[model samples]
Target: MADDTEANRERGIFIMIYLDYAAHTPVCDEVLKSFEEAARDFTGNPNSPHTPGVMAKKRLEEATENIAKILSAKKEEIIYTSGASESNNLAIKGIAKSYQRYGKHIITSFLEHASVTGPVAALKNEGYEVDFVNINKDGSVDLEHLKELLRDDTILVSIACVDSEIGAIQPIDKIYELVKTKPHCFFHVDATQAVGKIPVSFQNMDLMTLSGHKIYGITGIGVLLKKEQIMLEPLIHGGLSTTSFRSGTPALALCVSLESALAYTTGHLEEFYDKVREKNLLLRRALEKNKNIVINTPEDGSPFILNLSLKGVNTNALQAALDEKGICVATKSACCAVNTVSKPVYAMTKDKKLSLATLRISLSHMTTAEEIERFLDVFLEAIKG
Candidate 1:
């Protein structure tokens, strides 16, 4: 019976109409090609001193330089990591560790990804005080409340440039203006959901995190851009890799793929945005026509992510029904989806029903209008069932 089931599963090819770009994107073909070439040709350890090693080191430097150019940041500011989660942890913990003597108070928004919230929570357990800013119904941070929370002993103010759950783009520029005026406060942004999807500059940020997988690059690769003057303790110790901030055998292929992905986005941003916006509008219209649906994501947010709530339908059951029909979407952040409840979304919305019924549908440049229509058709049917 098991063998029969296995053979049946093998015979059925699941065509995933993925709508979860906010969680992670399928690696782009151009990025995969670049990565494959690097993996096959640049296998030498970057830390070695021999000729192959020298070449590998040069390749890594070139990749870093390319990514930095696209981000408008210095090459030295970009530190490679496994992904944005690690980058967020390193940024928060490293800063907390390095500057603990200066202050013990930290501030962050409740809507931040668990990657940020987890680190802040850990720091709080270790005697550091943390203040969590509340978000408005549209999922925007309350800037006045944040300002009130800021104090002389506040050492860090961390926030997400884009809320992964509701896709609301925070006022990072406004927050930056407010925080930069404080000489002692450092600003960190988890830009995993913002980079590549929208315009981003490092000018106002003390530190920022980016995930390769979120931008159609290979997984297990991310970037942390830190201001040159900012002090951060090393997360890992050993031979020099990423200015000794993170130490490991660098994934050269992943880095090369990330650089290629960035290049691709830089060249096609306008075209990509236009197409995604059109598809998003189409999807929004389709969902809006369904009186059972309530749009949760902000209307003005990133065109790539759409969050919705369906009345009288369980989100998990709806997701399962959609999966059975060969459509792919998510109930929440992939990292936290397995949990029975959405902790992050609840922190922002404070409505259990909104959090439980919420489904995130994200788009990529490759997503088509046909796919959106098919998904809506399937979704409407599923809700009826």
Candidate 2:
């Protein structure tokens, strides 16, 4: 019976439709090919002084230049890290430790990914005061409360450019303007979810984080965009190679892969968004036909993610049903999926039951209309059962 079950599971998975792009995306064919070719030729330490190392160093510099061009930033401002989580940690903890003399107050929203919250939580235990800005039902940050929370000692304000759970795009420009009143404060944005799907600007941002995996690049590689004047205490202590802030030998292949990923996405971003937007609309319309569901993502939110609650249904069971049907979705961040509840969704609705039933359906540019239609049929059947 177990052998039969395993075979059945494998068969079902073979036809699965992936709708979890916000969690992670497969590296594009172009990026993979570029990385494979570069890895074959550029296998040397970027920090080494040998001839082969010089070739690796050149590749690193070229990748940095390309990434900076995509982000509208200076090449020198980019500091590579393992991924966005580390970048968030380095940005938040580094600033808290280095700039606390200026002020010990830090502010962030409840909708932030765990990476930001984990570092902020650690600082609270060390005597730094943290204010968690609340969000409206639509998942947009409460600007009035954020303005009220600012103080002379508020040295850093970190906000996610887009909420990965619900795909709500925060008004960073306005937040940047309001934060300017504090004089000593610096603005940090986690653009992990928004980078490839939407436009991200560094106009008034002091620090920004990006993850390569989220944009169809290789895993274990990311970028931290820091303004030239902003100083941070080093998180990793070693010989400085990439930037004075992060110490380690750079992964030359990963850098080249990330550069390729960013260039491909940005080059076709508008066209990609249009296609995904249509798929999102189709999914939303199908869900609307079932009054047993409530859409949580705002209409103005990014079309890449659609969050909804299945009334009178258990989310764990729903997830299992979807899995058996070879459909992939998420209840929250894949990082926090082990927990039974979604803190971010609960923070937005303040309704435990609604949060418990929430499902995140994320789309990619490659999503097809047939996949959305099939998902709707299976979803309605599962709810009825």
Candidate 3:
């Protein structure tokens, strides 16, 4: 542990046990290798007309095809972007802009990532009506409230497939059934946290967003999967690349890494999920042994995230203590940055103590049992102190 601490310190911040996979994952070695190889051989602009460019374009095409195969979607339906933020921006704003004439109202849940919320807020500023559905005490979106809000003027129904702060898995199938019954409304899912951690079928989903960095892939690349018949106005336009949806030379190397990572996760998902569940259960049981601590994550929530509240403990003090002991976790969505208050998801749960004193311990396939045990040791010591 000392040697690990030294190495981590040399790397910048020292956190021996990194349990914040929901925020972002370290790139897998295999994905890194593929990224390096692609960078070396496919450096040409994918949209250029030269031989090298043609080769790079082919690599991009292959990568898109591979990822589409994994998602069971058509290649043309996949649009590459810088990351999930861009994908969500394009999906929400593009749809809102394109379909504005048909309807000016859009419905979404309050627990969505800032990427989605920001766009919806911007749309509201521009005179579009945006209605947010309430979440249940367990942090799940209320589908009945959504159904009540649906109207002929509601052009889109957007929701996060998984609550990033609380780890509650939304019932997308049930939401889809409700939305599908409304012929005028299109369904979009921000599946950034759910993509690799949970099984997702795009069969009933019209639009889905995925982030590469969340699934051990290289950062700066993401995918927006759209149904074949769905159309949205282009977000960025200039070059002829990306079928005019997005313009500019595609990141061939990043695309390759993202595809490879997704394929690897899809193949080993069952084993990985089982291991993650075992580790999470171990940590949860150990943490619960302390009568003062409360488990906040739903029992049936995604296996990778554990949200906890330490009674009579200040979150900042606990966080500092954990950091000193070389444990890394977070208090809220990393997207919101450190030191920020809890998100709407926590607020909706109505457990004020848990909401404010919460800590999120997110896991990954690479997270080990030993790391989890070490975390509990440090956590208990911190709480006691």
Candidate 4:
């Protein structure tokens, strides 16, 4: 997922058909209110021992416990980081560095966001033997192939609960079953795209990462849930703050906002999901008729995201055309457009041209049927030429 601030603001769109919720979302009004109140009332460093600091620390812990409760994790397991990128790095590098003596092999899939793939690549450079797990044609992990990749020496297996590009939900529980049989292996999941949109279970995961902005919370804060027995080398080294794993002044307001956002998202998850499903089906039915386009999303993919590619058209051009007419969509992840090709699409379809022409039109509960209709009209018009 990416930032909404980058939603073609340069085009100065006053009216927008924002089909890019998978990239990022607007902050929830209630979550924003909670943040403002926290900022005003809790104005002390949580690390300080003063009265104000004590009060602030108390609220921060309260927020942490609230977040942990919602995720079915222990309060002590929550580690706040700058965002999901930092959390992914901390989990991947931290675990690899901490357990290198036990094993040097790691496994992941092409469906992971840049955060997971980047850290895994960094580990590869540092003499860790890394393997790419094969994914099914629908963009889900090929568990049979994962079993082949698993070995006594495989230390970490990191995959996302949902692929942000294709919205394919992975079989985390089944995968965890395979990974845990190896005593040295640790299972990690980047649930950034799955948490609030769907019911994400923390059952068999040793480490999990989630972003606040992806769930209508404040942007700079993210949560990483680590099991009690897992020891990770600290990514940030300094005086202890909330946890020894990552160090910084506790973000009182962001923490409050995160709690509020999760509460709201989960409280009405089924409502939001069912509504988004209708919009997804509407778009899918309309888009499927275009012979020049190929739909990449799976039959059982998350309704919040749809991936497709134009047969001969350059996706960036279509994206720009849509932007010019007040529609916001994504050619790739917010951070990955420069790559100019969709790696996930290639992995799913094995067609180089289609991968190069992919566009991701993501939906959200906030989306209206009118917006989808407007988008289809504009999108079809733009591609006609």
Q: What's the TM-score of each model vs. the native? A: 0.94, 0.96, 0.94, 0.96
Instruction: Compose the digit string of candidate 3's lDDT tens values, residues 1-385.
Output: 5636667787886757888899989988999999999999886888889999989988889888889999999999999899999999998888888888778899997678889989999999999999988888777888888889988888888998887877888889998888877656789999998888789989878899999999999889999998878778878888777666888778888889999889878889998999999998998878888898888788899988988877888987787777767878888787775555566545576666666787889998788888987887667877786
Give the top-scoring candidate (lDDT). 4
The segments of candidate 3 whose C-alpha lies over 4 angstroms from its true place after superposition are 2-15, 337-340
* Each model's lDDT: 0.85, 0.89, 0.85, 0.90
The residue pairs found clashing in candidate 3 are none
TM-score of 1: 0.94
By lDDT, the candidates rank as 4, 2, 1, 3
Q: In model 4, where do residues sit more than 4 Å from their true spots?
A: 1-13
Off by over 4 Å in 2: 1-13, 337-339
For each predicted model, how many residue pairs clash, with residues at least 3 apart or on different chains? Answer: 0, 0, 0, 1
Query: Candidate 3, which ten residues in sequence have the lowest lDDT sum?
Result: 338-347
Alpha carbon deviation, residue 264, candidate 1 (Å): 1.3
Prediction 4 TM-score vs. true: 0.96
Clashing residue pairs for model 4: 2-23
lDDT of 1: 0.85
